[model samples]
Target: MKTYQVGGSVRDELLGVEPHDKDWVVVGSSPEEMIEAGFRPIGKDFPVFLHPDTKEEYALARTERKSGKGYHGFKFYYDPSVTLEDDLLRRDLTINAIAKDSQGKLIDPFNGQDDLLNKKLRNVSNAFCEDPLRAIRLGRFLSYKHISDFSITPQLKAIVKKILDSGELNYLSSDRVFAEIDKAMQNHFPEKFFNFVVENKLDKPWLKDINSLDGFSASNSDLRWVELSCLNHFTDFDQIPLPSKIKKLISIAKQLANIEIDNILIENIDSLRILRNEEDIMRILSLGLECMDQNLITKIVLLYKDIKFAELEKLDPNERKNEKINLLKDLVSKL
Candidate 1:
């Protein structure tokens, strides 16, 4: 049996990025043999084990057959005679299919090294279509790597179009969709993810009339908070500021498109101070309010004060109308 370092660890090491995790492919090994060698079996659908000594994942060389649809519908086959070349051919991307030996000798059975040198993302084989998740994975890889130069191969695009046309994306859970998006957002160039979503028409089912918001591109988290803020009609003055309830408000404000109004509101530093919530402070700052706009800032503070006072009173007939007028006045002042 031969244990080889494989997958992202080898790919990332060549790219000069510290590898996040390590996976190994064990050739000529069986579950019973692994167990005899003191490895713990962990996978339910496939042959995977954990190295008793190193504690790293050690999966036997295997191939998969499509059983149904989406990510979960796959049947795996593990054979001790399957070579590393066979395992690499079954992978999604060329860059990911390459591996390294224990002594650091690189394996290039699929010419992944050439694609890596060209900074390209290419599929390993026609078997790429067996799973539909590759399209999302590729788009996310482009976003995370800030890769604009590389183009998806025609075959891959054809598969992606097929997947989109079939409306199988709706069958995918929101959690899985967000998981991919959240990972993409961790990259510094999150706008690329948004662009990918728009270009591939993936946003149609999830977001309504997304193109109507011109020049608005944001990470999934940013968009979520922004939508929440807008839905709440967040104002600077409330008994409890909405920003205090939402953690990502400042990030959302930064992602907003029509931010000229934010510029005007930020001039009032005192008003922001009185607000006392980080989200409120960010909102005021985003509106371009200055620290020394005494009159404007005082007006904003008074508005919040009145709103809070109205909420405190149980029997003030004009309180509701008065609060509305004050909030409107605050918005108009910023405009």
Candidate 2:
């Protein structure tokens, strides 16, 4: 069997950036043969094996045919006859479809190397839109730190729009969908992700609630998530899957957002039972101070830090809450 390093690793290396992970495609290989050669089987949908020593994934060269409806309905065909070119055709972008041989020779069956040099992001084939997830993945790549400068070709945009029109977006798992957004949140320009989604009409029911920002440069990812979720008119916190902690922060952030700056000094901030932890609420407000430049938020957070929660523990829960609110109002009145 012949092994060739394929996918983003090859593309990234050509772009003069260090590859984060390497993926290999084995041509002229079978599951039985791979097992005999000491590779462990792991793939549920296709024939994928792990090297006993390196533990990196090595998938058999395969081709996909749309058997039913969406990308999930594809029937995979893997055998000794599938060529290296066949596997490349199944990739998302031309830049990602390049392969490097074991001898370190570049294989450009689809001219992905040229696309890489031009700093262009384009689809490998018309089949790129078949998988709705690529629209999200491409958006993530657009916001990637290294290749953020890459231009999305008009052809690529049309294909991605086809993905939006496919009506197969919901076919993807929520975890998979969130996984892309989470990665984009960590990228250099996360706002570009949302913009791209909106530009290509990729923002369907899943991301329709998010209002695209002109610019958002929040350093913290959770804070960034909070900012985006609150951009929606109704703030669809339950529409997307998020960790409980992030959901809590979004809930608190929304509360702070809805409150008029003049009305922050209330009897008890947790009157709605939403803002549970003072520390969490302050954290969200602190980010609000930086991102939104709400000077009132800074004063509220600073005044909160001065109030000693330990001293309030001596009183009952109701009394302690009232005392804390009284102390906050007293401090705000002094300012």
Candidate 3:
């Protein structure tokens, strides 16, 4: 049996980036043979094994045929007769289809190396449109880099648009959608992912809220969720699985957005501090102050600072809290 380092391991090497994990595509191999050779089978759907020593995944060369609508609706075929070339043919992108042999020789059956050199993202075959998840994957890939010249190939772009138009993306599970977006957010240019969704009219069922928050700077991914929640009036915040910090920020931002300048009482400010802490209160107000006036942020910050050091410290703990609230009420009344 011959084994080849395949997929992202080879793709990242060509891009001059170090791959964190390596996956192997084994040709002329069977499940029983792999287990006999000390490989532990791990995959439930297909013949995949882990090396006894390295513990890296080594999947038998296989091909998949579309069985139904979504990403999981695939029938996989695996055998000793499946060629490495046949396995590579099923990959989504040409860049990902290329493989490297044990001898460190590059295998380029679909001109993947040429496309990689040209910094182009091209589909391997017409089967690229078979899986709706590829549209999401391609979008995430586009956001993976911060390159100024990064773009999708015209044909691939058309295919992705077609896939979205067919409504196949709606079949994708919410967890999978969130997983792809979470990975994209980790990229250096995550805004590209959101832009792709908007440009292609891709956000229908899940990302409707985010799509509405157009032109909002997403340079800080931590703030993106807050921006999404604050920009749109979410009736059910519990519907989306969000971290405690983000959920709190959203709730605070939403409340602060509608808060009247005249009704900013000392009790309300003190309650915010007691529940969410002072730093988070500032962040919530900061979101409201975004794109409006830099001076408002400055003034609010100065007020918070002045309230901290005012004569309220002389009072007892409970009275001090009340005094601080009164101080904020007095200052907020002016604004």
In lDDT terms, which candidate is top? Answer: 2
- Candidate lDDT scores, in order, read 0.64, 0.79, 0.75
- Give the best candidate by TM-score: 2
Candidate 2: where are CA atoms >4 Å away?
A: 231-234, 259-261, 265-294, 305-335
Poorest 10 consecutive residues by lDDT, candidate 2: 267-276
- Higher-ranked by TM-score: 2 or 3: 2
Model 1 misplaced regions, further than 4 Å: 35-41, 51-55, 146-148, 207-209, 212-335
Q: C-alpha displacement of 213 in model 3, angstroms? A: 8.2
Show the colliding residue pairs in model 2.
Answer: none
For model 3, how does the per-residue alpha-carbon lDDT over 76-166 read when each residue is reduced to its tens digit? 9999899999999999988899999989999989998888778888999989999988888787887766332556789998998889888
Candidate 3: which stretches are off by over 4 Å?
36-38, 146-148, 209-220, 228-240, 243-245, 265-276, 279-335
> Candidate 2 residues 176-279, lDDT tens each?
78889889998788988888888777676677646677665477898788778756653674546889888877767766665555555463343423224667
User: What lDDT tens digits, residue by residue, belong to model 1 across residues 1-335?
Assistant: 98788877888788887877799999998889999999999988888898898789999998888887777778888889888888888899888898888888888888888887888777888777766666677777775563545667677777778878877666665556656765665665555665666678876454332331122233344444453334334322222222343444543343232233446543232233344554453443344422223354445445555445445356366876566556656655643
Candidate 2 lDDT score relative to the true structure: 0.79
